[model samples]
Target: MRVAGLVLAAGGGRRYGRPKALVRHGGSLLVERASRTLIDGGCDPVVVVLGAAADPVRAVADLRGCLVVDNADWVTGMGSSLRVGLGALLATDSVAAVVLLVDMPGVTAEAVRRVAAGAGPAVLAAAGYPPGRRGHPVLLGRDHWAGVRATARGDTGAAAYLRAHRARLRIVTCGDVADDRDLDVPADQRGGRRG
Candidate 1:
């Protein structure tokens, strides 16, 4: 199956005081680390959606050689960035997209593979972590692109779509909560690296 990976790095990082995508984790920038996982998983022609700190992010990500999409409407919200990235991925290829978040530092190549492995026309990688808390980075087939674009409810994100099409959703259980953790605040960004 043809699969394209889209990394969402359009967040402004208002809570973190700096671009979270540019933050270092284990000697590599967050975006670079995230993109590499996708690439390593055999997801070719990856694209990164940049917004708040596009320039800085681009500098670090340039070496990875992935396409960088600037999401000017990022201030609008995460939903807008997701749409832009998905639209870009769809516009260039016919492959299904495995959307990855920049702040999710612990998301590994194996996890990405697990998510994409079970991808379908309208399935969401409802990642269950620790005690049943669910997380995102859902896989979407090209068929659901339009629905994702039309989504505009609350901050509920892709949950709305998955909920509406419950029968189509697939749960990819993961033991690592880090795959589910979103590093939006300063504390989250640091805690992952500590003892």
Candidate 2:
């Protein structure tokens, strides 16, 4: 099955005080890293949704070999971005999408690969962390795109839809292979090393 990669990078980063997509991590922009992770994870025709500071992100992020989508309603919330990303993928031959967050610098390509493996048009999968915590790099089958778009509102992207169908959701254990830490605060950008 062909799976596309969707990177949500359209947030205003109000809490972080800057666009997370442009934020630097490990010598590269977060958006660049996220896109690379998706590509390395076996997703083809990756689509990146850009909203806040879209121009700057486009100018800086090496988005070659990927489709860049603009979300005008980004400030409304992540749902809009998710909708936009999934909508863009509708034009492709992808049967599903591996959704990743640009702020999640700790999530690895391996985790995405694991969650995307064997995903069919009706499969719903998410990366499971230790202690039964669920996180990103979620696999959304083409069959659920319409419902996800309908319920996606504010910052709650597909959470409600996923919850409604949790019984059928596949949990791919990734705690042992990847970390799902998100860069939400200034301290998170400090690399956890006090100078």
Candidate 3:
């Protein structure tokens, strides 16, 4: 079965000041980096959910070859973005989606590959970092989309559903290939959010 990519890039980044999707890091916008990562990771089709400064982001980000969707409720938080991203893929042939946050520039395609190694409509997996920490690049199977959408709310987003299904979650160790450190502040400025 095919495993697609879903990027939640709709946050306004109240903490980081500007929207995370527009944040430039390592010579590329966060949204561009995220979409590229998914494409490089072997995901057949990638979808980016835009919110906050959606129009401005589209004007500059290199989101070519990917499906871009808008989240009118993005100000509400990541949950709404997740719901929208999942909803967009409801008609696709992909059996699962490997979710990536736009703010996490450190997560590599290798990490995405590991998490999506054996994705399926019934499979559930997530990347695990050092010292026993389960983090992003989460692989959510099609079977649980409805439940995830129903419970997804606020900034927590898919976290609530993953926590409840911890037993079924296949933790893929990705510490060797990637880091989940997110850009919290511009150093020159103050804070930020994720995509």
How good is model 1 by TM-score? Answer: 0.87
Candidate 1 lDDT by residue in tens digits, 7-69:
888777787788778887778888888888788766777888889889877665543668888
Model 1, poorest ten-residue lDDT window?
152-161
Sort every candidate by lDDT, greatest first.
2, 3, 1
Model 3 lDDT tens row, 11-39: 98887788999998888999999999999
Q: Report lDDT (CA) for all predictions.
A: 0.73, 0.93, 0.91
Quick one: best TM-score, which candidate? 2
Once all C-alphas are superposed, what RMSD does model 2 give against the true structure? 2.3
Clashing pairs in 1: none
Off by over 4 Å in 1: 152-156, 176-178, 192-195
Count clashing pairs, candidate 3.
6
| Clash list (residue pairs), candidate 3 | 8-195, 9-195, 15-191, 15-192, 16-191, 16-192
For every candidate, C-alpha RMSD to the true structure in Å: 2.8, 2.3, 2.6
**TM-scores vs. true structure, each candidate:** 0.87, 0.97, 0.95
